[model samples]
Target: GAERQVRLPLGCHHPLVPLHLHEERPSYVVCGGAVFTALSQPYLQHEWGKAWERRAPVSLVAKALNGSKAQRGEQVVLLSQLLGHECVRGYDSALLANSMVRALNGVPILCLAQLAQLVLACRQRSLRFDLEESRVLVLDTAQARGAEAEILQQHNIPEPVLINERDAALLR
Candidate 1:
């Protein structure tokens, strides 16, 4: 991946941001249940989502990025910019475990593909996905059997990505 500049529109409130190459975690969430810590950051995030949002669903995620046309669905994918857990702002909270606490009940990650969809959506709406870190994404593994990044402002948690260490080992 190459380095580039991106500008944020709504929640970020930033003009532009610099993105680095290979700076993101490689973890992912799995399609079935259970979390595997040995995986990379992107993989972990993907796997967790799949387990949590399979068939019968729960809540959703919505992204109002500058250039994205917001997606409307009970089951939508999260964007890369909106990936990291939110930061706590209380005076004491900042110094304490507030950051962790705020994330105690939030989606904390996504993938490159999810970020792409977000970028497309923003581009469609004339917004920017300026250098977002810790992004979230939705994977339609059931249909495509592959990961696809989607930045839905009004979407539920995405189905977790499948983690098959045996197959991954083969690929490596």
Candidate 2:
């Protein structure tokens, strides 16, 4: 399968990346099997993945919200490689959109779950999140997974980081 990716206007300086040097050569994805199979892998510390511990799913969701419209060539490489311990991975479109929206506005991210609901609500009720190079986001469209859908249906919900059980359960 061709994994879809939207490159943000950051982190294009992969010196040894062959495809970058020779555009004639097609780029191949470094497959991350079982997404969390090697979550303990080593990585250099940087600002890239600071949210894994600090904001987690919420931060990621916000990123996705902001990433929807990034240009074709620009992309943000995952800052840290010690990756894949949660449902919200670097390529998760829904989570990235959520995070991107939050980061762009400098707003307090109260809840990932509720935000996910809001993400869907915006689509249903005509709210829009700003993002680019859209990832295959399911938070709004995957209604077969009833849990998130129900959350969207609720009223007077509080803000909180989320791990949509229905969505998470499907990934597991």
Candidate 3:
């Protein structure tokens, strides 16, 4: 009989697995008073403790149980944390955490790298972030740019943004 071969879909093992995980390249981005990162099982576990599946938000648990990549090189980018700043005033509610980012500047966000690019290259007067559950976050572009350095310093974040080269290339 002739040799038989089968190919399985990539990232089929786990729905919450991050698209990119590397030491040199960070999987997170900090900009405009928000921390963006890809959703992963470890993050869920860390945030929700040992009983993450049960303790975590129902929306997240549902994604973990049944979510799949709709397109190649896709990642579940999320607003992991919100920093206090005038640029992001009135959005300090804790409910914003772990909310999946739907789009930035009306462009769909596929990965963390893409989100970073959208933020850094935006020339509009404001940066709009569309999130899950009909939540919308808008920040003044000039204020955000000007406040980023101060926000980083206050939080002691070394870099404003860090993204994997491979992930960045995928968007291009």
**Local accuracy of candidate 2 as per-residue lDDT tens digits, 1-172:** 8999987786643211111222221111111111110011011112236343354443333443343324332222221221232222445433442223221122222222333334433434222233334323222223323333233234222321234342223223
Give each prediction's root-mean-square deviation over alpha carbons. 20.3, 18.9, 4.1
The alpha-carbon lDDT assigned to residue 4 of candidate 1 equals 93
Model 3 has an lDDT value of 0.81
Most accurate candidate by TM-score: 3
What tens-digit string does per-residue lDDT give for candidate 1 at 17-44? 1121145343233221111112222332
RMSD of 3: 4.1
Cα lDDT tens digits for candidate 3, 8-68: 7774454445533554454788877889987767678878987988998888877776787
Distance (Å) between predicted and true CA of 76, model 1?
31
lDDT accuracy of residue 66 in candidate 3: 73
* Ranking of predictions according to lDDT: 3, 2, 1
The lDDT for every candidate, in the order shown, is 0.25, 0.27, 0.81
Instruction: Report the number of the highest-lDDT candidate.
Output: 3
What's the TM-score of every candidate structure? 0.16, 0.20, 0.84
Go through the candidates in order and give the clash count of each: 46, 34, 0
